[model samples]
Target: MNAPLLEVQQVSRSFGDVRALDGVSLTIAENEFFALLGPSGCGKTTLLRSIAGFEHPDGGAVLLGGSDLLALPPNKRPVNLMFQSYALFPHLSVAANIGYGLKREKLPKAEIAQRVDEVLETVGLTAMAKRRPAQLSGGQRQRVALARAIVKRPRLLLLDEPLSALDRKVRAEMQLELKRLQHEVGITFVVVTHDQEEAMSMADRIAVLAGGRVQQVATPLELYRNPANLFVADFIGTSNLLPGPSAGQHLVVRPEDVRLVAPGAGRLDGTVADTQFQGGTSTVAVDVPGQAKPFLVTEHGATEAVRGTPVGLAWQHEVAVGEGLA
Candidate 1:
């Protein structure tokens, strides 16, 4: 097998009382879009910072292409970090801001300009090259930051909550844009994000972290279908965990998997407590007598379920077994 482009071997970090990263280890392939996903204070950011040389690990080593990345200073490392804020200079034009790093390197002005223009076109910001940060939209500014990072041609690009600054619509747009840019630049992108959907939409592989430990590392579909443990099943998406046939066993079922049937027709029966219309789909909350929480069912298109209506909840038993969850 080819060696991984980036290897984080048993990396750990602590902040006085708290262990921010506890023996976390993972690898990223060349030109891969990777994501470190977790809730706030879950060490995803800490791990990202460690890779970018902002934080030194207390143990283990970080390797980039078989070389020790920890031994190099932040600037000396072949990596660029894009902050959530985009950090574009308000006074500098988009072209100038994108070329700032090259200028600092004392590269010839023509070379810097050529690289800046190429990256601007790559990011679809060539038309806005003359505009200052203040004149650009939030999404445009994010593009500027991305263009600046890629203009340096770093081996690895680290993004800290890259889409958190945009509004919902813009965030959605940028999610696809990010994936496109990663492919276009062919750079290994390691993004740290608390948003599960964002990671699912953008990452080629996702490392779900919790309590300073990596819970699971898999593709979005694999992680969603075959969660390594209960935490992963619960965290990745909405799962209806029900009592299994055996003692002390539970089966994880997705809302979409739960089918509504006639009375006495399925494994469980419940009463519809509420129905939520969500554009293309609807969520029906069913109150099963024995279950502590209401069981949710996702239905395609519009659904009408009057409150207190009796409903039967059924799902394919083999689905759980197929996923190795049973």
Candidate 2:
């Protein structure tokens, strides 16, 4: 709708013989929180870098707000990148770091100070304005980095694994903070991350990439519940991949969807191979006859079966079947 705020058309990149990105294309609407998610080396970072003008694509165009970004330098484009490392000037105070971009633009001192103060308050770091990077905690440092990026009032913000360095609890807090900041500022945020949970919890839409190609793009729930292909189903979360003939090919089903019934109650019988207790949930591995690998079943109820117990396994036909890939 409204002509996407950012359009990436047939983007491709290569280094020597290795193709890092292959004919990838996507559109990001204004004020959308878009995430590029995949395993390491899947080209998510390359795509973000291409948008930020750090990496030039071998083929394709990156357009921002209908303007060709390829024709401009990184600074010339209305984009700011908040690097993963925080990239704070350790030597500069919090205010100084936040005002770094404004200083480079040669804005008047009063204006730079006013904008810096506003952003510091917006990120809730006004109390630590005099502190340097070394004086702040991990979360504070992250906010400083964010304030620095948003101070320039760019049309788009690029984040490259911005929360990967923080501890789990702090990372979770920052996720909500980032979302709130985005809503308050109303700027488009495109983040590149390999952490599935991070992307699932934060993004409005996720683009799953594999081997330099985009596998699927959808809302978090849509991607999780109705994956387009096998790679996406396995990557987004824990699942049981059962190998069976379907239209002369293989099919998969989720572990939670597979039910364990009394022996002789279902079509298949399996011996309980192992059990793992994870607080409130349990995962039971069942070894079925004629199958090389065990089938994993995740149940929320307390453990009822012990190892070596014979059980019947069944799944709804709809859950057991996945669309066959070509």
Candidate 3:
């Protein structure tokens, strides 16, 4: 493989005595949609800001396109950051705001206008170029901010929870728009978000971070199916973390992976404890005879199980165990 477009080597950051990032390192390929996913205060945003030149790392170097980025100022680096709030100038029109970066470079009026028009078209904001930020809806304002960032044609774009402020429907719509925009522009996009659903839906590869360290980096499906550790298994989706011995390590299995069989058909026997119906699927909690807590089982098209019903549970060995890598 060719050298990565962005290389973060042993990056570490601290605030007095507290460590925000601890010896974090990762590489990002050109034109890839990468996501830094973690819970709040896990240092995902700190890592993004470090890459964007907003926060200076005390320990390691950030390299972009084979060049050290530490020596360059934020404005000189080939990166643009789109903040969560959209950060649009309230007084400026959409077109003027999109053209702000180009104008600051001392480019000629014709060139700035030309580039602004092109980006407006790219982001589907040409029709509302004259409208101020307040005149547009949430989605339109987000597009304008995106156009402004991309107008400079930076080599990399950093997004910090860009869709978190929007409603669920709009957020889903913007996810597709962001993906389409990335393909059309063909630039590297690194988004930092705590929402697992957002990362799973949009990222080509996701780096799961926890407690200021990276836990696992893999495609969404791979991370969901084959997690490297217990944190990843529980974080990526809903899973039943059973304290059963396997290969000298504790095991965890997703609710869907635990299959309910006829009585005396499986190794574990349980009594149904509770049930929750969620549209097409239902979840049933079973109290295993030897276990202290109830285990959850997710079944589709079968919601008839009631509390106190005897049942057998079994799961495949592969889904029950994950290699212990924390």
Candidate 4:
């Protein structure tokens, strides 16, 4: 949204017969927490590696501040990449792990120590500075990896599935922490993740990729509410695709948008085939006639409806997202 900090223009890459990236372009603002979100083999990682200069693209340009980033060697680039693996040296202390990059740079030891101390405090790991990677929990280990990456004060940081190692609860907590650290560190973060919720909850903006191409780029709310096409609608969240009023089009409705009504009272009636209680809310799947998949509707609190109960699906408005947007 602001002046572009990183510009990827018409980038294309191929691994033998497979086109890993095809004409992918994006502009990321400075200090923005951007996410490259897609399923496996979608080329998000390839694009990231291209930006980091680890995997050179077959064509096109990667620019940082309007200069060619692909010109620089990987070690010479002013960017850091944190792999999914923590990559902390088992024998090294947390402080040492964070300071290793500075050590490689041949900076004065005192400066490295001061920076490490400051980062340790910022990441809330000052108390565990002396602990080895083996001694830390999964979350703490992830913090150590992040600390190591950021200690260099790189212009940008690339994370590859940074939360994949943690359990669900810790993953949620670290998502908050990662966003906090991104703001405090003031470094542009570009994370690659297949988990849609992780991207939606943590990123400032998301770029959804499929078949090695970008499907859409927007804020999480925009992507959920106004998906550019069918792939995005199905990928970003669950959707009920009812045949549209016009041919070759469909009306999209989310579970939260659909209302459950008495049999034959609304637009479509069906049998309640399944009910799922997920804590505060419940999901009721109705098997509508002429529909291959069950239509899902959300009900607040708990669902008391039993299987085989007759129900109807209702919604106030019908929208065709766009003509041939798919």
Top-TM-score candidate index: 4
What does candidate 2's lDDT look like per residue over 253-297, in tens digits? 778888899989975799999999888889999999887788888
| Model 4 stretches astray by more than 4 angstroms | 318-325
Q: Across residues 34-136, which tens digit of lDDT does each residue of candidate 4 receive?
A: 9999999999999999999889999999999899999999999889999999889999999999999999989999999999999999999999999999999
Which stretches in model 3 have alpha-carbon errors above 4 Å?
Answer: 1-3, 244-248, 289-294, 321-326
lDDT against the true structure, each candidate? 0.91, 0.89, 0.89, 0.92
TM-scores vs. true structure, each candidate: 0.96, 0.92, 0.92, 0.97
Q: For candidate 3, which ten residues in a row score worst on lDDT?
A: 241-250
Please tell me which model should have the higher lDDT, number 2 or number 4: 4
TM match of model 2 to true structure: 0.92
Model 1: residues >4 Å from true position, as ranges?
A: 1-3, 245-248, 321-326
Instruction: Choose 1 or 2, whichever is better by lDDT.
Output: 1
Full ranking by TM-score: 4, 1, 2, 3
Candidate 1 residues 251-302, lDDT tens each?
A: 8889998888986998899999999999999999999998989999999998
Cα lDDT over the full model 1: 0.91
